[model samples]
Target: MSFKYMPVLRSRENEKRAFKNFFDNKIFSSNTIIPLIEIIQYSPNRKNTTDSKLPEEIFEESYVNEFKNYDFPIIVDIPMYIDLNSNIKQKYKDFLSEMLSNSNKKTPSKRLIYFNKLSKLKNIIPVVSYNPNAPYPLKTISTQEKYLRTNFNKIAFRVFVNINTITHILNEVEQSITSEDILILDLQDDDYKETKFNTLFQKIEDIKTSKKCKTIILNTPITEDIIKKNKNVQNDCPINAIDNSIVFSYKSFGFDAFGDYAGIKKYLGPDNNGNNYNPPVTYNIFYAYHQNKYIKFKSQTINASKPVVAPSITKSKCWNMYGHTHHKNCPGCIEINNKSIDTSKPGNWGTWQAINIQHYIYTMNDFL
Candidate 1:
């Protein structure tokens, strides 16, 4: 049986239309824009999962891309708002300023209007541009019908349940456990630490049995203490050491890539040809190729951080993907050994991204 209140996926056409409407409405608004921004700034901050914090303006950037990338179009059932102080209002103004400056590349007038709308939002959570506002956000549903219709290739939706509500969802997901694998990133402890060895191993076993998740990616720092603790575990999850030479190799370029093979010493550079062999960094593009998903478990970088579920990979070939700086040089993508090749483009290089839970389940269901 399906959950009653869970939001259903919408048709791709409808999603596109709704998103267009959302943006279009903002562009047309005058008196409404500043209040909207106030609402967003005043709203309680959402939690982020990565330890590396980005400027608040990044969310504004995300708003622009969400339209470009998402097919299903995520919407909250209510108009969520935030309450902001003078400091936050100024920060948001700066973000709006940057976005407005860049608007000339696309629809300049339209973007400006949208920014104006953002400025108008007052005392609201700033649910993705069009998400419905509610007195309390609970049991929100994301419809993906539109994404499927667009042939948008890879599309996934993540519902950001408050930390307080996550345990409930986890319980629901666990109880509904079918053949679909349910992986959990228990952020309570470091993956490579001995102090948490018994705890980690026990959780792993529990997931293997009850949760039945196929792959479980643990998050933990490779601190000296944690490393010392893991000395006894003959086998451990691929540890992407921060100072590894291979990590340094690719990082010197750009593109933050990270993955299991990233820490492999064999891939390290200074070849006989005097070329630098950099390990891959993790990005959304890589995850798409691998068909994976990423979940933020512990984001220590940002104040008022919340874990978010997003693609470990992206379809865009333009920019190399990077996540929070959990471990420096955690290569998510690998470069082919060729002096003449441009590694950033899609076809020439290889990388890894995370597998979304929804898509993973859908795939498993098909396989069965």
Candidate 2:
């Protein structure tokens, strides 16, 4: 298939209250944007693979329900399966069957169970993964496809194309047992940022053209400099066709730029050189979209009862350091390290502006 959906990666729990505000408003609006929400589960170790859980367990039913409340589709990602040992292979099969099996009655077959799950949960999608590094038999992927397509009239499988094993893209197409709804090119670019933009883009194009499935590249979109000049102004800032590329990063999932990585921990200080070595925090901000929903939080610092508290100054604006800026030694960042970055209230000046900077580069004339 050519492609039909825009992808949105899922965000962490604490930051979700912010995005829910947007979904609630859409209940009445006519315009629509349905982004793919991904929930990727991580593996703890190289061996002992039987421990893998369903995507529901890792993402959690409570959090998944929050996303479910919205009208968008959910892509549940479990660990890559082909390379798993026999124990894990059988365990995963059973787990999939049980989760998708009919709730009120018994399923006639394994295929029927998955079909029922897909039917019952109209918005939920399953993802099968391939790891080229360990290099598992392609037959595993082909077999799973057959099982799924047995009963469902139309089904889409989201495959995580790990960047480490880029070679599998070509084979992924030829070996596919049935047509796919969408293929996710999961890029692990945390350490590989400088890989030429065109190089990756070309491979993606080739894969999409060769396969019957709609392909989506998942490398982290380069964060645009929002604190600087307007990216929309042409001439001065040339348009990066790459920014509009048919690519979505983890941030697209509409999760928090903060809290995703930090979890319960707060930001600590920097190293001797003043560089940010703060390991307890991670921020994910999406590019090319304007305006978003943020959670209303109250700080416990001001009073065991009072509200209002807060970040730093940049370019004459009280930028929310926790949402956008991660630079240590700054006023807001210092507060976080000193346990003083206690921000209260949603749409609070700092976070509301800092969360996701969705500025489009095209001029109004382009749309006209």
Candidate 3:
């Protein structure tokens, strides 16, 4: 696959619609991508310890029937979506045993039964989500997780280590998860943008050297410096996948899944059946409305009531928008100035976002 972009499905409703879309072939015509989801407890007080807060509704008959519609591997994340809000008398494994067992039957000793049932599904590669809580170090949790994974057949299970935990408890993490498991990292922090690329590259290099997992950067906005062309290290790392949740983000912005826009609707393929362009449409020259480009996101940022302008939409500010744009900023200050984006293009916000996703995929391919 060409740098998989696994979109995260965070809720029951969100997941339901996404799965329906997948079954109907409304999105992801390409096999290179799949919907990713994290199992989480919706309620702060999860009274039902026996029931899983994750994989919330997928096991129901309706969802099982729906899965027969498509034949693509889903990158299922099994990381700890949030800390356990309530205390339990038994370990998580005990809870797992009860979850997969029949309503009247008890199988507290055979936890692998859960994995066996899940593994039967030919389309999902479940990287069981994990989080170690307050009292234990990551090493302990990692060891327990590995034990759980071993109960199932090798092909059925993988591990997803949360970035926050991995960064701190690497040794214990190393003990628990392997290079084969997926490590989830996100550069959503703006503070990270200020650091040298070499620093980040070195960190990635070290992680790759140690964990050696199929790595992923998730739910991050496309930034110029992160994907700037001509940077060799960007493509040299072991990072295997990425997900741009701009569509979901747009929905959060109160739009109805960006379906409101006609220009973008055409690209949201239904029957195209994975025709993500032959040879993978490398975004070189002629990418963004012909010629290289720069994009500066306008902001409504301020400190208190004193409005501060986003450096992006300014006269002198500059950013590396996938390519260098040493363009002098001025009024009508873009177009020619931005070596990547042409202001002359006719598109609304939705159209621009769709084009931007293309830009992201092509640019990230350089890293893969």
Give the Cα lDDT of each candidate: 0.26, 0.35, 0.36
Measured by lDDT, the strongest candidate is 3
Tens digits of per-residue lDDT for model 1, 48-78: 5354545444444434444334232222211
RMSD of 2: 12.9
lDDT (Cα, tens digit) per residue for candidate 2, span 114-156: 3334444556555554444454554545555555555443344
TM-score of 1: 0.23
**Candidate 3 lDDT tens digits, 50-152:** 6654543433333434445667655443343223333322233233334423312232222233334445566655554333433323344443355456543
lDDT of 3: 0.36
**Model 2, poorest ten-residue lDDT window?**
359-368
Error in Å for residue 306 of model 3: 34
Rate residue 161 of model 1 by lDDT: 25
